[model samples]
Target: MADGTWRPYRVLLGSRLRSQTTYRRSFAMDLLGSLSVGALEFGEIYVIFTNVDVLGELDFAAAALLFALATICFSLADMVVGHADRLPTYLRQGTLDAFLLRPLPVLAQLITSDLSLRRLGRTAAGVAVLGVTLPHTGITWSVTTVVLLVLTIVAGTAIFAALFVCAAAIQFWLVEGAEFANAFTYGGSYAAQYPASIFALPVRVLFTFVVPAAFIAYLPTLALLDLPGPPGLPSWLGWCSPVMAVVMWAVALTGWRAGLRHYTGAGS
Candidate 1:
């Protein structure tokens, strides 16, 4: 936490940022592409609203808030920890062993190794949705509401970042398990964008309790809008986002430590 302790990481991330920006044209195109994908993802909800007045008890504006919260959180998490997906490659190349020899923590080294500047485009798109929808959701703004909104973003990001780390840690065992991990990390993002009420009991349990995706957006949106959640999920559950984030990080770190102990390096 000390300034000097983080100086090395700052230097590493600074170099990565500079390397990414070195090619202006490529970086711009990457940004535009990321933005376009975000727009198209939101367009699905927009199109849905065109046909239905409400989906999962949420009107267009309310739904937009749901989408924006999930998108911003997921996009930010992906920008920060998405590269953990490369753990398998690092293992194959023996780069992970090199990390073990370094003074920095392995996870910190991995997280600070690269910075995805282009994902900011997705974050921008999410911010745009939030701006347009928050005022129209018709919710009375209070200090609590403001704090909840900020907490939703922070906790949601933590939930997703922990998910990425969890998946990466599992890769220490599965080796070629990117697809399997994506089922949670990326799949959780996909699920978060929609309301939990839209899902059946099994899926609701899966995303809500197992994956904890529901806490990322749906439950918080319900709390913010003062709406009741469907059977088994109460509005008060939204306030548990921080708790869920802590639980997820705990799980992720445990898996990471176990995987590290299990790993015998690429040669083995």
Candidate 2:
């Protein structure tokens, strides 16, 4: 809230941006790889759709928009906290001790340690797709719709980031269980890229009630698309993804702190 507090966050973000730019060649390679991979994935989806009229209520364009939104959100989260995802490995290998000695906040230090330049291309591709497809989706665009879209994207990013933080926290106990955590992180992203209701009822309930992932993509998309949601779910619920994100993040922070305490005791 204070001017003094803002400077450190700004400096940290600037340093990361500079660091990413410093490796121009590697960054370029990463960018190209990311773009190619995204294109290939989308191409497959397009090919599959030639035989089917729709996946549930989502037509091709709607599905593409969902994919684009999910990809962009995931890429942004990956860019911000990619290193945190690797914290389990670092802790197990004793490399995290070095980070503990640093004067910065543990969360900040963990986040800034690694950056994935490849995700920049993915993020770019997502934005490009959304720009091309949104106009054709039949949703009347107004200032209010535009604002909602921006908020939805922000919420998606926060939700993914919170998932990553929770995954990292789980690693403290099941150091080798990071693979399981990916079920939520990567699997959830994949699911969110589609219409959530297309999934079975049990799976839908898990994402909605347990992980709260439905709020990130499906609910918001439903609002933006002006579609009917499941019974008892309100249109206003779509707007709450960002709030859910904040709550998830707070829970993850508490878990992470507890993990750190456990780790320190074990190391001693």
Candidate 3:
């Protein structure tokens, strides 16, 4: 929490980057592989729209733009935020002992313990998709829209990161965590890519009320295009991505604190 905490983080970040660069060819392939996976996902969207002009009442470009926005925002989050996913492994291997001895918070150490630079490939892919689709959306260019767009993306990233924290927090109680949290972290990202309307009522409810992923890009996307929120949601909710982000973060942090307190390593 102190300003000094960042000093350690900076040192660790630099060291990790340098070490990762040692395998430049491996890194390049990892990056390219991630990008290819993203492209293939988007390619499926293209194929779907080719059969019909619209799915979920939005045209192909609009839907793709929404998908791209989620992609960009989630990719940004995963690039660094996904680093939290390693907490369980550390706990199981007793590697977390070193973190407890450090002056910095264990969460801080765990966050930077492993940085997968390869995920940046997904971010690049999202940016490429947005670049191609932005010109066709026909959304009027304005300062407010731009600001809202930025906020939407930022809030989206925070929401995704917070989800990671919650997912990782559970590891404190269950050290041998499998892909349990994937149902929300990864699943939420996949569901968020397109309009929520396409999903069943139960899914919409689950993601919206339970996971709050609808704010990541679904409602924000609608708000960006000056469209209305889906049935069962308040009309003004789409524009409240920042508020949603804050609320979700509060919940995730509370869970994290509780989990940390409950945590007693294998030695205990």
**lDDT top scorer:** 1
lDDT of 1 by residue, 1-268 (tens): 6999989988999999999999999999999999998999999999999999999999999999999999999999999999999999988887799899999989999999887989999999999999999889999899999999999999999999999999999999898767899999989999999999999999999999999999999999999999999999999999999999999999999999999899888773
Q: Candidate 3 lDDT, tens digit per residue, 1-268?
A: 7768578889998898888878989999999998987898798889999899988777877888888888888888888779788888777777777888888877777778767788888888888988898789887889977997899889899889889998988878877754898889999998888788887899899988788778887787677777766688654676788887888889988988898888677673
How close is each model in CA RMSD to the real structure?
1.1, 2.3, 1.8
Which pairs clash in the backbone of model 1? none
Descending-TM-score candidate ranking: 1, 3, 2
Over 4 Å off, model 3: 1-5
Error of 2 at 170 (Å): 0.8
Please give, for residues 25-79, the per-residue lDDT of candidate 2 as tens digits: 9778889998887777677668868989787577888778877888888889988
The global C-alpha lDDT for each of the candidates, from Candidate 1 onward, is 0.95, 0.80, 0.83
After the best TM-score superposition of candidate 1, give how far the Cα of residue 69 lies from its true spot, in angstroms.
0.2
- Arranged by lDDT with the best first, the candidates are 1, 3, 2
TM-score winner: 1
